[model samples]
Target: MAAAIKLASDRGVSAIELVFARNLFSLPVVATWLTLAPGWRAVRTRRPLAHLSRAGLGLGSMTLNFIALAMLPLADATTIGFSAPLFATILSALVLREKVGRHRWLAVAIGLAGVAVAMRPGGASLPAAGLAIALAGALGTGAVNITLRQIGRTEGVAATVFWFTVISLAVSGLGLPFFAGSHDWQLWALLVLIGVSGGCVQICNTASLRLAPVAVVVPFDYLQLLWAMLFGWVLWATVPGPATLAGGGLIVASGLYTVWRERQLHRSHLPATPTEL
Candidate 1:
């Protein structure tokens, strides 16, 4: 998903074009599920404010992410963006006052170290602008994840996604005047493909989490890096250096450890017989 977004941006496509394309592509599947899924009527929520807030966060994260993609290699962009989960863990402890253990904090430190390695200073000649944008995107995405956790308790995933699409479309549309321009057929197809693939990825992600434990599934999310690398090399011919590879490994390890700790915490809080939806 990140690769596709960056590819479109590299081709000089606007963020609005990318966002609208994703929405249009995912519309069919979203519409079908919303219409035919059992208990679809029960998914509506009364928390309009929460929905709007989440949607705004989503828009900010995605927009910043697109900008980062345009400036950074796909693998680098994705690795930096992956820091969101670590940020979420730290923020949860600070803002929500959740109890965080030393082990988790250590994991966060290691993850940040990895990010630093990947984003070397003037010595290694890394793109500071790209790293900065990726960091901003990660922070925004972390906030969105925290907000989603709060809202998820009262709203179904479908309802959350629905509001996200609506709000993101509306907000991104307003920015059209700034970046909007003409596009060729190829650009149009790629933009639309981004939108459709993003929606499908979200659905798959939700289902994957429901079907398997986070400890089991979160590691696979790293596969996105492989995809990003492949796309970056094959399409853009951007190969990562030694520092990037090492830093990405550290990030993945720390991220996986953090996820494992989170799952342990969640299981500790829940009852023996988990409640079914």
Candidate 2:
């Protein structure tokens, strides 16, 4: 993610271009693997509308995130984006009718406070366009997560990923003629690397979810912020301000608390002993 952000910043690539590059390069590989894999079949959906909606939201999220990366400091962009999980929590309560306790709500509020700290007008003074892009990305991500939760019971993960890539590629391709421009070999290589890394991140994320529950994996995501800061400094000499650091720390802490609370809830609902085990 940090590498992709650096590439976007350096190349002045548009969000749509980065998204197109990602899906154009990665989807074919995923589709081919799915085609060859045993027991693979076309995803049958009673609710095609829901599937399409989720795919659209996913594509929008990716596009907005790319735009934010291009426009904001890597650390600030990443930190602000981390608020997506909090948005997801709130959305899940409203959309999924999931019971969210007071504690979780408090955590969400605290996390948003962190976001405010990072985005305070005089502190970092990130361009309004960048802040808007980041917020849009976070909201889009929350929508995608809610839609995924609604349809996940009926759709295979690979199918969902595949369709998202298809939608993203199609949408971006439609706009490509307007934004098309030539790039040198170096920029092309960076774009390729971004695409590859994006694909690998998705694969790794899927693998992690399969290996462990989401609560176990989510906390590790905070490490991305650290990586973003490091990459920004090393590559672009972008050092975050004190307020940004404080805000980022609060966001990470709140996120970790949310994960921990989720784990506790999961454990509480489990039977005292597993009959199979």
Candidate 3:
């Protein structure tokens, strides 16, 4: 999805246009699922406000990411975006009031350091604007993660995915008139890939949060950095700079530690045997 965004933006699609195209094309895919698997009634929701907030946050994250992809190296943009997990860890402690042990705190700190390293502040090598935007996108992603968990408690996974996409589609539709453009066949193909991939990802993301604790689930984002790096090379003939590699390494390690620590903590709290239960 990130790659397609880069490809489209390179072809002169503005970030807003990409957002609208994503939701516009993806809406049908989501609607198909809601119709066939769960029936249309699955989308019934009483929480318009929560959905609205989600739509806003989701759009913010997607827009920032799309812009970052245009301005930065693909690998660099992706690694920074993957910083969402670190942001999620911090948010869980402060906003959710979850007990954030020193281990997780340390992990979050290291992960942030990774972001700084990858960004390489005070360097002329990369665009500072893109770095800042990518980080903000990551922050937006973290906020979305927390919001999804809250909504998932009361809403079914299908409803949560359906409403966010629907709301985002509507919101982006309103903005489309301002950014409208005629695309050639190539750009249209990229937009289609963006929409389909984005739709599949939305379902996977909502289901993952509904099925697991947020911390445990979000840390898997680290794996994306690897794919991003590979795609970065294939699509653009670009290899990550030393700073990006160093920073990406830290981000990956921090994510792994966060996930491992969560699992360990969960194991410690579980009863050892049926007799204990």
Candidate with top TM-score is: 3
Candidate 2 accuracy as lDDT: 0.74
lDDT of each: 0.75, 0.74, 0.87
For candidate 3, lDDT tens digit of each residue in 1-277? 9899998898888999999889888888898888879888888888989988888999989899899999998999988887898888788777777687899888888988998889988874888888889999999999999888889888888888888888888888887888879988988999999999999899999999888877789888888888888999999999999989999999888888988888888888987988766
Q: What is candidate 3's CA lDDT for residue 47?
A: 92
What TM-score, over all chains together, does every model reach? 0.86, 0.87, 0.95
Error of 2 at 80 (Å): 0.7
Q: Rank the candidates by lDDT, best first.
A: 3, 1, 2
Between prediction 1 and prediction 3, which has the larger TM-score? Answer: 3
> Runs in model 2 with CA error above 4 Å?
32-39, 42-46, 203-220, 269-277
Q: What is the lDDT of residue 264 in candidate 3?
A: 86
Total clashing pairs in model 3:
0
lDDT per residue for candidate 1 within 60-92, as digits (tens), equals 788788888888888888888777767777776
Candidate RMSDs in order: 4.6, 3.4, 2.0
- Clash number by candidate, in order: 1, 0, 0
Q: Which should have the higher lDDT, number 2 or number 3?
A: 3
